[model samples]
Target: MAVRRALALSAVDRYAAMMISLAVFAATGRILGPAEVGMAVLGLTAYALIEVIRDVPTAYLVQQPETSAPAVRSAFTVMASISVLAALMLFLAAPGLAHVIGNDDMYPFFRIIAVALLLGPFERPLVALMRRDLAFDKVALVNIASGGCNAIVVVGLALAGFEEVSFAWALLAGNLAAVAVAWALSPYRRLLGIAISEWRKVLLIGGSSGLWGLIWRYTDSLPQIAFGALSQPAAAGTYSRAQTIVELPGKLLFVVVSQVALPALAAQRRDGRELKGAVLDSLAVISALQWPAFLLVACLAHPLILLLLGPRWLDVVPLVQVLAIARLFAPLELMVYPLLLAARQTGRLLLSAAIPACVYTPVIFVLASYGGFATACAYLVLIPVNTLVGYLMIRRELGVRATEVLGALSPSVLVTAGSAIGPLAILAAHGFRFDLPIGTACAVTVTAAIGWAAAIVASGHRLSPELRHIALLAWRWASPRLRVGS
Candidate 1:
């Protein structure tokens, strides 16, 4: 499949999943208090750390030059063993973990979430196989089905007053749905068997990735865990929600791009194509979209919280604004990981992850004791430092200079400035207050969108031509319909 088509499918899938998740989150936020939400976050964070191991097998399979039946089966065997063992360990540890978090009531939440870990062995490797063939349409189908089921289950249970454990049950249901859909659609549906002959190869490639995954997961999870342990009852949940909101753009853009990037870049390398141009183009496109989106989120933080999580989440507004700004340099960090993975530079990838983990984890933990607000402020410093380390690594590995990277990103700066004008104007007019009337908020959004479009054309960012093509296609489609109606 063409890369663009793959990206489009991934984007559609991610956007749909995001909407479903947001709906569930908003519903639950309204139905459950911050303490309940915090407990759920703690449980999910623990699950996510364990889930990092599951990605190792998937990464190994996806990056292979070619796959045989034995290799696929071996990957599956590894994943299944890891999943079952991890699930059992987590189940046994739940009580102790809950006690450590100062909430013995969280034992059930952790145990329920552990049950979802078992589904990983069944679902992830199949998805990886599909992604290997660039069969993103099939991947999209699986994701949409899973997400729909998850939304239904979560909303239903939350409305029934199951509280935070509703999320745990919904997670298990979603993974089961994904497993069923993937099993039905996977080309490797009949490739089921166990073999360890290639286990060494899988482990060699995946070991570093797994380690990096562990560090990366902990880096993200530690702050929240710390909040759960050290801060007020609501701090963890509030921070988690703020992160959810701030990460929407990254999840939408970076996740879609990265899903397509690693396999695509690996293919390019196998074909003896130079990766420099592709890397630069990706940076340009990512910055152009990501920067403007984060800026808009910062500008509209209060109204967004009002609209999405209700007034009950008002404390999250400033955290969202701060984190959104901190995330401006995120494109740099996002570009590095897949590039390293594609280049088979797992060592460098491990180092890149380690640098940030070593630097920021302890500091964030300390700040967590103070409050979520302090923790958010720490990211303002942490992200830039992380980005610099990543940029240096990219430079060292790819031999791409600062000038080249800056040149690619320059147009995006203009585009961001242009996109920010309307929102900033509105904010300035309102003395930078985020609490605006619905109609005014709508006006700000529309004008900011208009400004973004104008800037895209004016600055000639890489995405401009694609935007024009989409516009032309839309016009062509609408013209005949309008004439027929008239």
Candidate 2:
């Protein structure tokens, strides 16, 4: 029942948030120029950095199941303090940072977003705590409401001629809304007199996680910075759009799993076997759902881009395709990332995160300078290689064999391939372009449905009893409803 609630609520929140964000981007992109959009991206990048910087304390506070309310509050206090300091420093230094990235216009936008940074600490630990407690329903409600509010505010500001500033303002409004809702729902209130020393236990944990998070941020952020420098703002915006679309499904999956998985794993931390089993099950479920999404996006990149963003975004199709190729491996990254945290493999986690950070940035910069966005994305082809290395390390620590990992993921691969073939054949038979978006969507949908059905059939007619039971229950529930309607 809890899982059902979480799944249902999360699906609603994810769908709503995705639609709202896409709407905001579409509306704003029409109003703002490339440079303004670039600054908007820069503002978002800055905000992400600030949050990464705060990740240490916030992560530690949220991850520790044994932590007392007072201790958790104090950790939040420390993070809040650091966030304020960072925001202030960044606000003062926005001009220099903007200039460093070769965009003077970003300074004002960056400064505006810096105020939103202060709200990050208040919001982060709360959501983290809620996730730790497995209160996903509340989390979903809060996220949907927050996203809805941000979307409305952004559209309003765009109409009011704020242009690029609308994004920054929308972020601030969203964070404010989330913080308010989280606080109202939280058992404890923010205290003005919370002391720093009370947070010593989780402080070190946060600091370590924060350091690793900063490295991960650098890994992801370098592409944007390099693209901005090597290519034009329009090019960077295009790349950003590709990333936004490619990442949407992965982010939705991450949001749902992250909220549920950490606490679930942490609760089973002592039972390594059970924990490993749970993780495998999670990978199976995620891979089954997520693989089709990336495949669809990759197959339909050109049409999807044109349909969603108009002709101006056509340039992003190739880059989006490249990204789609790499994103097929994203679920494993999501699965292993939390497992490492739960296993107290902090040093290994840092090493795993740092390696990608260290390798990806310079490669992108050099490639972008020599070639273009597509070449830079070519670097990401190595992600599967890196993911293999990560899982090997995780397996060693968890005492699970590589075969176990392979076995768990094998079903998903078969199902995903089965589902993808129909779409590929149909698209190949009738070229990539279609007369109508609706027609393309329908074709893709039918293809995927056929593929999934084939996959279930091919899984040897002895499907997992749990899944079989679920199908039976679903049919039993639906048949009566169908009859009633008839």
Candidate 3:
């Protein structure tokens, strides 16, 4: 119930944030111009490189209970130091990076973005404490407020003709507001202090985890960096846009799970049975929604792009499909990373990520250099191998067998994939015409829902236990109203 509540609040927060972001996007185009907005998006690659500073300290705190004030203080102290140093370093490197990307104007904007690194560490202690107690309502409140504040600042500054600086200033505003809100919600008022022994333990536990963070962040941003270095400017922008389209759903899934999974898993790490049950249930819930959604999106990509993005983005159709499929196999890795975090087995997590980083770092550069169907094919080939290695680690460390995991996911994979057939058929039929109207899309959705219902019946009502429990919960509330209506 706590997890569900957190997820519900998270969903609301994400929706609200998305709306705010849309406003900012609109404002940037109208006021700051598209070029400025594009440059702001380009600057996030630098932020991604420093993102590990945010996660490592949070991990250190989340694993420890809120009562560990000394450790918290030490972690905060070290985190703040790292943030300041990172900001300084990024500011120093901004000119060089801007030069490399051949955009001399971006140097100050990059430096301004680095200021966010300094403030973000201050928020982590408060956030980690709230998450440790499952006090996500407060966290959600803070997030909504901060995101709203960010949009207002960015839009206002852009209207005032701040241009690129508006984006960077908005980042600072957002982080500061978040820190203030999170701090208000926090109970402790611990002063700054650092002990070598405590810092050593945090480093020992979170350092390797931080390495994985670095690897993950680097991989995510490497596409941009590589594209900037190797491909045409238009090519990099195209990849960014296509990625924005394909990764939204996956990124949302990641945000929700990443919020709840570590704390929930950590709470249950003591009992093997409980831990295993949690893992399977989480996987089932994830598979039930994500796999079908990915397939549906893949099948309906052309129609979707036509409707939302217009005819200009037709080139991204195959990339969208390949990435959706890639995300299909992502659960195996995502599920394992949090479990390892709960177990304080960051070494294994690092090992798991390091394998893929080696392969894909080069792959991203190649993909940037040569992007059409060939790039998509390389992704198809490499991502599964990465999943395989991660699964092996999960099995060895957590005693999570392939059979048990598959059993948990099988109902969803079967029924949901079956559901996608109608949508897939509709898209296939319209492929030659390329005239899928909005009504056609609606019909596709309705047909898919019917197919989903039929598949459930055909499967003898085999439902994921997680889904079944949710249904039963809903039924308890809805049954009385239905009885009265009848």
- In terms of TM-score, the best-performing candidate is 1
Rank by lDDT (best first)? 1, 2, 3
Candidates in order have lDDT scores of 0.85, 0.74, 0.72
- The predicted structure with the larger TM-score, 1 or 2, is 1
Task: Compute each candidate's TM-score over C-alphas.
Answer: 0.91, 0.86, 0.83
lDDT of 3: 0.72
Pairs of colliding residues, candidate 1? none
lDDT score at residue 395, model 3, on the 0-100 scale: 80
Please identify which of the two predictions, 1 or 3, would achieve the higher TM-score against the true structure. 1
> For model 1, how does the per-residue alpha-carbon lDDT over 368-483 read when each residue is reduced to its tens digit?
88888899999989998998889877786677888999999999999989988998888889887889888878888888899989999998788999999999999999999999
Estimate, for each residue in 1-486, the C-alpha lDDT of model 3 and write its tens digit: 877887777677777777676566545545643345446666777786676755576777777854576788777877877888888988999988777666787788888888888887678777877877777788888888798889999988988888867888888899899988987887754543554448877776677768888887776666667756752444554455556666766666777677778768977776544577788878776776677777767766677766645565576677777777777776675687888878867678887878888888878777666754455566677778787878887786667788998898787777787788888787778773534677887888788777776666576444434446777899999999999999
Candidate 3 ranges with C-alpha deviation above 4 Å = 1-38, 66-72, 155-165, 187-190, 193-197, 231-233, 255-269, 274-285, 306-315, 372-374, 398-410, 432-435, 460-486
lDDT, model 3, position 205: 66
Q: Which of the two candidates, 2 or 3, achieves a greater TM-score against the reference? A: 2
Residue 85 deviation, candidate 2, in Å?
Answer: 2.3
Stretch of 10 with least lDDT, candidate 1? 224-233
Better of 1 and 3 by lDDT: 1
TM-score quality measure for candidate 3: 0.83
Using lDDT, give the best candidate's number. Answer: 1
